[model samples]
Target: MPRIALIGGNARPITTAHELGVDVVLVHEEGRYEPDFADYCSRILHAPIGDSAAILEVLRPLHAEQPFDAVLSATEYAAIAAGEVADALGVPGTTARTARALKDKAETRRLLDEHDLSPIRHAMVASEQETADFAESVGGRIVVKPADGVASLHVHVVESREDAATAFKQLREAGYTRAIAEEYLEGPVVSVDTFSHRGRHVVFGMSEYQMNDRFVEWEVSTPSRVAAPHRAELTELVGRLLDVVGLTDGPAHSEFVLTPTGPKVLESHDRFAGSGAPELVRRACGVDLYRMFLAVQLGFEELPQTSPVNDHGAAIRFFTPQPGTLKEITGLDTVDALVLTVPPGEAKGNIVPLLSRTREAEVVVVITRHPGDTLPELRSVKDCSSGYVIATGKDADEATAICERVVDQICFHVE
Candidate 1:
């Protein structure tokens, strides 16, 4: 069996690697991996996934004894480090130089601006004064986020210098020493879930989102109707991004805004789109991207000759309850969805995706709350979710409708 090293992702890919009869080693942060992941991994190692030196320390010895065929990462935060490991091991995957550049949003923005690919006004700010200066230069609202932020953490929209300083301070406290400040692009943002294999790029489709004031995506639907008109534009831009970024394999999602001028790229990722994007891809297009990630690395699958088309639709609607003590929750009889158990604030068990299937439609409900746990407010993508409902239908509208109807039935009573 071909041995593969998967760095810093959920258990889905580990399980996929195991089922494919590959000897998989999982490298993750201490106390961060799911318990059930050990069952799938041939060897489970612990290291800060962001620290390339530490990860190489653990993997280098093992690799000398038995070589690893490739290194893979589906998580956004660890993609660069995973690439570094692959390069250090002389493995086939994302290169170290490419991953480092992609991880830095400011660097990618500079590349885009230099190439005149998708120009969005941006600057790299290291201090509050720099942030404020950039914000003032825009003369309008600007978005300030961690230079390597993931899961929408510490993203601040500031219109004033004071606001920019405050945002910078918050990021500083969060241990992010530097940040990217950008002129706020005013348009409906959509995700282009594109994949590449050996320099070839293809977009599976686009997805739309419903975001809160805090930028928490409450609802997500694939094959966006609003973005369909600019398919040619998005496809062309992604092709350019792949070329400029040197993304070699796996999934890389680039977000673009349908601005008044046209489509301008907001940002990009060298990994699979999160928020159950692989599930959405599987439902809409007959492609399991997560499985594809593992299979291609393990040499069990080949890159497709043509891109998969999105025929149907799939949607996920999160349950965002009030931030208070939970009193009670009602309305379980309406939807026959799976109930996943977890502690109120945090979960330490297997993040199993719960699904109830039938021929016509399928419903997957992942509930992270119970009767006594306090619910947190919508913040970053990490701790905000109380639960979520995922469904698939004939079209994007129908899939979104199924999610909304199911979400309406579940009620959370918070004190």
Candidate 2:
């Protein structure tokens, strides 16, 4: 059996690893690890997943007892630790340098600029005036965001020096000293989700996003219509990107903006696409990325020489309910799907588990916030965690319509 060490993710990968007949050890922080995961793994190890030394300290002894075939992670930050652990233990996985280059937007920007891959004007800034200077140089709209931030938090779009200064002040107050200011990108955003083996890249699904002003994706669909004409270019670009970053295995979710000029990279990750995107790929391309994450690592599955064809269209939509204390949520029973509801103000660890389990249900309704919970204003993905709907259709449009129709049937009564 291929013994694998999985760091800091939900239960999907754990369950999949078990099904692969691999002996898996799950590493996560205390209280955060799912209780149900015990059934799938032989041991559940706890660690501060983001800390490389801490993870190494825990896994080193276990690795010495019996060497691991691979080290992995499904989370964003923990992937770096996984890489570092893999290197330290002399296991096969992404290198720390590659993971860092991919995770840090500033590093990615600099690397891409050096290679002249996906060109976008960007600068790392330390002061408000420096940010304003970049904005002034752009002479139009610009986006200021944390160099290593996730979930669209603290990302500010500004066209004026005053707005830039205001955004810088907010970021500084938020304890983000390392920020990047870049010229704003326009056009539809899409992800060219790929799986690679030994540096061979295969495009699995080109999922497109529909976003709110905050840049949080309200909905995403597979087999990108907007990026249809640019599939070849995108595939090549992602291949170049993964090659540049030294990502030789697992999934790559490379997001891009289809500008009038051409496709420009928004960002990319060294793990599965977030927010139920792997599910979107399965529904559309008939490819299971979660399965591939384990299967490819152990060399049980061969890398498809060609990109998997999308047989159908699929989409996922999130619930951005009114921002207030919840009074009542009604109309859920009308939808023919698995509807999970918690107290309005209760804890919601909703997204990851629901994304993988909403199988066979044409529509899935997940409500993370229950009655009396305060729905803070949707400033970032963090605030818009009330719930979401994932659906499928004959095409992206159809799948999106299915999600929309389901959302319509469910009503949130927030005060």
Measured by lDDT, the strongest candidate is 2
lDDT of 1 by residue, 334-400 (tens): 6776545454444542223332121234776677777778777678776555777888889899999
Tens digit per residue, CA lDDT, model 2, 1-415: 8999989887778888888899998888887655677899988888899998999998889998999998888888697888899899998887888889988999998889889999888999888889888988888899999988888889999888788789989999999886998899888888988898888999998988888888888888888898899999998999998888788888888999899998998899998888888888888878888999988778898878888777789888878787888888888867777786544333334354445567858777878876777777777766658788887788999999988888888888988
* Residue 353 in candidate 2, Cα distance off native in Å: 2.9
Off by over 4 Å in 2: 341-350
lDDT of 1 at 132: 83
Alpha-carbon shift of residue 181 in model 2 (angstroms): 1.1
| Number of the predicted model whose TM-score against the real structure is largest | 2
The window of 10 residues in a row where model 1 has the poorest summed lDDT is: 350-359
* Each prediction's number of clashing residue pairs: 0, 5
Question: Model 1: number of clashes?
Answer: 0
